[model samples]
Target: MKLSFLGQSYEASNPAIAATDTGETLTFRGKSYSQKQFNVALRQPTEELTYRGVRYHR
Candidate 1:
């Protein structure tokens, strides 16, 4: 379940998007991703995300 996010590459396991009073944020492992630059990864996936100008897929 390799995924491509933005345009860069990364490895994610059981990734999840967490939203609070601030905004939306992608969290996985021990890292947190808040859409900034374009990035992608090849490993595993828990979901497919595509919103506004952000894109995450396998």
Candidate 2:
């Protein structure tokens, strides 16, 4: 069985705020997000997945 959760994506919406580098940060609309969220959304080119804005990578 596969369980899933809803998440946000960069494609449908333009986050408006953005950042670069490890220490730096980004924000979707006004909510703050981690670098992984930005990377997975903008860089990886992978399918949509759950991103809780914590523990960016496994």
Candidate 3:
């Protein structure tokens, strides 16, 4: 999906988006971002992201 963050737009695809550090960190297209950044950028549900075998509660 297309998302905007920090006044920048990016195209995020499936499986490429994941989170670590207990949902504190988000990785997109090989670039690492904070959960807050991702949340602001993402227009879709957080459930669409792949976690570390755990469900993320945001």
TM-score of each: 0.19, 0.23, 0.25
Clashes of 2: 0
Q: Point out where model 1 deviates above 4 Å.
A: 1-22, 36-58
Top candidate when judged by lDDT against the true structure: 1
- Model 1 alpha-carbon miss at residue 1, Å: 30
Among all windows of 10 consecutive residues in model 3, the one with the lowest summed lDDT is 36-45
Clashing residue pairs in candidate 2, if any? Answer: none
Q: Is candidate 1 or candidate 2 better by TM-score?
A: 2
C-alpha lDDT of all candidate models, in order:
0.63, 0.49, 0.60
Clashing residue pairs in candidate 1 (N, C-alpha, C atoms within 3 angstroms) = 4-57, 5-39, 5-40, 7-39, 8-39, 8-40, 9-40, 10-41
* Candidate 2 similarity to native, TM-score: 0.23
Provide the lDDT at 1 for model 1.
54
lDDT for model 3 comes to: 0.60
Global CA lDDT computed for model 1: 0.63
For model 1, give the 10-residue run with minimal summed lDDT.
35-44
lDDT of 3 by residue, 1-57 (tens): 999999978777654444344557778999997664222234455444436886664
Prediction-by-prediction clash tally: 8, 0, 0
- Whichever of 1 and 3 has more lDDT, that candidate is 1
Q: Which stretches of candidate 3 lie over 4 Å from their true place?
A: 16-58
